[model samples]
Target: TPPDPGDRIPTGFADLDTLTSGGLRPGRMVVVGARPGVGKTLVGTGLARAAAIKGGLPTLFKTLEMGDEE
Candidate 1:
């Protein structure tokens, strides 16, 4: 069955869901900024993976720093 629009968005992290009173709100942007050596790419890739591969939602990732591998 398809997920309902009124249903909650899963954080994919149980602990985070409890802390955030549910999960990330729709139409919200999450920005992760750092001075390099951080895991920004990893997190972004993870989100894309969850949305596309896991949640079955279409995803688009545009990277200016790296070239596409596939």
Candidate 2:
């Protein structure tokens, strides 16, 4: 089925959604990259939270550098 018109998956921030012309497109892969202590984990966790909690979308978060307990 086709996606609903004007449907957008919010990034949990209105400002960022506006900047991206309505958040992320459906079925698209998004990669967030940055130097250490630069909020890469912050952003990834935030997005995952938004997708899972706010948008009710299934999300998977994985990390290679950090351990399960951090």
Candidate 3:
């Protein structure tokens, strides 16, 4: 299905768009660097979830740190 003109766009990061021209565009790569346990994966997951839930776009997540518990 095609996107509706009245649809809302997900900015991924709510606080980020205020500083940039809208927000990250689709099919673009964003490199984020931070110390371990600083929520890098969490942020990525959150963005994917936001796009899926809020924007009605399908999201994919690949975790290199997967374990048997997952």
Q: Which regions of candidate 1 deviate over 4 angstroms?
A: 1-8, 11-15, 67-70
Off by over 4 Å in 3: 1-9
Q: Candidates 1 and 2: which is better by TM-score?
A: 2
Ranking by TM-score: 2, 3, 1
Model 1 Cα lDDT, one tens digit per residue, 1-70: 7655455444556686677666555555656566665776776676666656655667665555566773
Candidate 1: C-alpha lDDT: 0.61
- Index of the highest-TM-score prediction: 2
lDDT of each: 0.61, 0.82, 0.66
Model 2 lDDT per residue over 1-70, tens place: 8777567778987899999888777777778887778888888888888988888899987766588899
Residue 54 displacement in candidate 2 (angstroms): 1.7
Over 4 Å off in model 2, which ranges?
2-6
For each candidate, what TM-score against the reference? 0.56, 0.81, 0.63
TM match of model 2 to true structure: 0.81
lDDT tens readout by residue for model 3, 18-41: 555555566555555677778878
Residue 2 miss distance in model 3 (angstroms): 10
Backbone clash pairs for candidate 2 read none
lDDT-best of 2 and 3: 2
Error of 3 at 42 (Å): 1.2
